[model samples]
Target: MIAASDLPEVIPLFPLPGALLLPRARLPLHVFEPRYLAMFDDVLKTPQRLIGMIQPQDGEDEGLAAIGCAGRVTGFSETGDGRYMITLSGISRFRLGERVEGFAPYIRAKVAWEDFARDLGAPEQDAEFRREPFLRLLERYFEARDLSTDWASLREAEDERLINSLSMLLPFDVSDKQALLEAPGLPERREILAALMEFALHAGDEGSEILQ
Candidate 1:
């Protein structure tokens, strides 16, 4: 249970395009780049083992999107060859504030948590939302891609868990992924994901190549 006050005002930002971390979800990262390796080392020495996962607007030189989710280091392992394999547990989404100079090699940003306070706890389910349509679309999408998934596990997942997990796992375009990250709530995110999946399916049927 993380309180708003417990979150830091400034956090090291990891700007990887198409990578998203919704609250309560887990994101695994492999850190090999020198700058991010430095960032990882710095975080290891801190009491707040947190990092902000954001997507760059364009290339790494370009600006970052305004919103990103904060994740706390929950698992970590280091290779002898100088690399880090870590897992982060999502905390909450944050709106980026001004960038600030920080000790780490990576960029750090001041963030506002007011817009996503609800993310600290379990998401509220929408009684009116239908899961069948979304599930059907997902099945089709997986089949089209020739991806194998555990159906029993997916069926047993909670609504929020299912939606967020799929959103992170599916290979959507960068912009589409950002849209899902910025969605106001779980239901809205689910709707946006379904729409994106449908659009991709239609594009494939029209003989247009779909981006994985």
Candidate 2:
């Protein structure tokens, strides 16, 4: 029941490549890095417990993408070896604003939440989603990559969950994941996702043809 106004103006940033966290989706992470462990330590002290899950720009590891999602630390535990097991439940996507300069080992930035205020609302729906056709495409794509998934689970999931989870779990390029994150709504995200899967399938077909 959190609102945009209740969100913190600034949040600690975790720059990870190929990781996508969309609104209403949960992402589990293993925190072993020293700096990130410190980041979680500080984040736990805050009331909101939000962390900006961002991607490092495609080519360079240092610069961050312009858009990123902020996820609340909804689940957390510490392992015996000082590592952390945490789950982030996405709240909203925000535009990266000014980077806060400080001595903190992790990155923190001032974020603008107005553009994605819808993310704070109820789960989104894609009325135009064609579940059967999309599942067919997904099967071909997964078969090409030799990947396996639970069919029953996918069939039972709502539109947003199915698409967003695939967008996060798929082995698409880092830029692809960022594009999915930045999509304005569920429909746009679905379009980009289907396109990406189709392209992968086509590319695989071409590769097979060449080897034949």
Candidate 3:
């Protein structure tokens, strides 16, 4: 429920590869690294309690991707072993800006929020989504990879929820997931998602234990 004016210009960043957080989706994370644990401590003090979830770009020395999503800390608990378990509910996507230089331990970045203003407005609906076909593809994709899922839950989810959740949870390539995250809208994202699954199924590696 954070207003656009309340969103901070600069926030703590977590540069994990292959992780994507789309608007309104929830991502759960386990914080064990000392620096991130410290980050959570500092972040909890802020009113927004937001963190930037970005992926490190591909290659040995590439920097962060151009876009990332900001998520608010919704659920938090501390483990006896000193690790922190937290859930981030995605708020909006932001365009990456310059990294703030200092001794804050974890990375912090200046982000611009204008391009993705739609993220904060309301949940989206994709009228073009055909559930039966998409679910058929998903079932084949899951079965091909020996993956198991709750069919009932998927059938019960809304279009945006199902597509966005799959985009985040799927084992697509980092680049592919990034494409899904960067998709201009839900319909476009759904297209990319379906294409990716179709490609994977026909990629001649159906027997592979895990998605590549």
Candidate 4:
């Protein structure tokens, strides 16, 4: 476990609403918003093109969760006109140590990663309590959203792949998303995501037909 102070610090942050970056995940983001555009500029200037990806409470930026994950800029490029598109690769889980005033119109945070060493080789799979429920709920979620998911891809994904993909792409509320970010492990996160998906699916079905 690396110390928070020991982790390299990067200025400027990318705050995406209703999104969480879990460890070992790959997230692609389009940068067009002015604040994040400025963030890109700052990151382009240095080697520390890292950011703390945190989720704020629903409809409220002032109320942010204390825990977040650290993402390093893995692949980034610009079009001929200077529009920046980038991919964020999750490195480790981190907690917000303090609030930084302003780096580039976006909020900055002092962060410390979790002390425990996560063994990627072990896979950290939650076979019994998680797999089936998550898939079931995910199917229902897709139906409710009127989305046509590629089942072949979904079925082939491993635990980390499934969890990370769902965490980023799930259409849950900000608070719900934050909870997934703060969830302890694959088992817990999978369960919570299942429940949330079920809730959204049922609630939408009851109130209005999303398919219509």
lDDT of 1 at 29: 99
lDDT of 4 by residue, 73-160 (tens): 8898887876778887776766666667753477776765545246222457876655565677777788778878788898889977
Give the best candidate by TM-score. Answer: 2
Candidate 2: stretches off by over 4 Å:
58-61
**Candidate 3, residue 212: how far the Cα is off, in Å:** 20
Cα lDDT tens digits, model 1, 1-212, are 67888999988999998898999999999999999999998887877689999999868747999899999999999999999999999999999999897566789889999999889876657665677776778899988778889988888888888989999999998899999999998889988999998988887877754442
Counting clashing residue pairs in each candidate, in order, gives: 0, 0, 0, 0
lDDT per residue as tens, model 2, 1-212: 67767898999999988889999999999999899999999999999999999999744346899999999999988899999999999999999998999999889999999999899888899999999999999999888899999999999999999999999999998889989999999999999999999998888889989999
> Considering TM-score, which of the candidate structures 3 and 4 is the better prediction for this target?
3
Q: Which parts of model 1 have CA positions greater than 4 angstroms off?
A: 208-212
Each model's lDDT: 0.88, 0.92, 0.92, 0.71
The TM-scores of all predictions, comma-separated, are: 0.94, 0.97, 0.94, 0.81
TM-score of 1: 0.94
Error (Å) of candidate 3 at residue 78 is 0.9
Residue pairs in candidate 2 whose N, alpha carbon or C atoms collide under 3 angstroms: none
lDDT (tens digit, per residue) of candidate 3 on 1-212? 99999999999999888889988999999999999999999999999999999988764126889899999999999999999999999999999999889999988989999999999988899988899999999999998778999999999999889999999999988899889999999999999999999998887475464565
- RMSD of each candidate? 2.6, 1.2, 2.9, 3.6
- Span of 10 residues, lowest total lDDT, candidate 3: 203-212
